[model samples]
Target: MLVSIRVAAEELGVRPETLRRWESQGKIEAPERTPGGKRRYDLAKLRHLAPHKAPSERVTILYARVSTNGQRDDLVRQRALLETFSSANGWPYEVIEDVGSGLNYHKRGLKQLIAQICSGRVGRLVLSHKDRLLRFGSELVFSLCEHFGVEVVIINASENSTFEEDLASDVIEIVTVFSARLYGSRSHKNKQVMDRLREVAKEVSP
Candidate 1:
């Protein structure tokens, strides 16, 4: 299962330079070279990258995430549950865990998992919940998985009980920020108003 560099690059939907960049960045295992020094990629590896197989026939990825270090134990629990799920299904699995805000896209573990997904080696992905994977626009990622023929299984697909609480937090944070700005903008007028009220109160003898 050996292929010339051009064929391999074409199959990967990347330019040859991209493949060379992948090698340089340690994003992929280096391809072997021929005696005359031509690059060759193992076709098996390339095939594994995006095998057109049914869901049950492919390797799985278990992704676990927590918003902050405070939820490290929750992250562990997520991994544990995913591991159990993967085991029951009898699929070879890898767990990718991250401790960062779901709103963030730059987490190291998240980036690595995406790269793996892009390589097409992952057949399916299992997550405890949707927001555990991201706080917003999770559908974009799901669409990417669909485009790549990767299945996404959210163990809990229903509305989360704490969704309102989380949403409230975001709303409150926004309100508090703007409330401060609203006051700060009229500090001079507000001070004058307060002084007048105090003077009237004194005139009325409390």
Candidate 2:
């Protein structure tokens, strides 16, 4: 059966505000309201909506990424930290490593992690930091986790900030715009050089 908002909050071990924020962000579906406008949540839905419990039998998945080739060892460090963290917490976990620019989320290791989450094989996703897992933004990752009912734990931040506050779409949009402009300028320069080459070729041919 569904529970009330207050009960859900208690069960989830999060503030009502957090739940409200998740709803606002579309990270999770909004709860159904009663005649009096009180929110109601089903037990199954509550389990799905709630964050992964700190101590649970479910397996936790760790994702670590390094931006450059020099940072390959950094991936190892991240894996170590995740292992230590999980061991210290007595949580059974596995490590998945990806070495690449955080600018793209389509890395092979990331794809495997997402697939596992989508398949409900993972209960929680642990990351070293927002930038490590999401230099692009959190929305895409957040939405993916929310859709699959997986909990996310960013180990770097003790408190949330603007990076944590804004929607993922906004962050990704900014990155996309910057990338487009950079490529567009380069394309323009290349086109100009090609045009000059064509003119020189025509004059020489005559």
Candidate 1 C-alpha lDDT tens digits along 23-52: 899877998989999999996776655433
Candidate 2: worst 10 consecutive residues by lDDT? 164-173
Worst 10 residues of 1 by lDDT: 171-180
CA-lDDT, candidates in order: 0.72, 0.68
lDDT tens digits by residue: candidate 2, 21-118: 87899877888899999888766766774554333556789888876567778778988988888778777888888876566767898889878877
Q: What's the TM for model 2? A: 0.57
After superposing candidate 1 on the true structure, give the runs of residues whose Cα lies further than 4 Å from its correct spot: 1-57, 159-163, 169-206
Candidate 2: list runs displaced more than 4 Å. 1-18, 21-57, 159-206
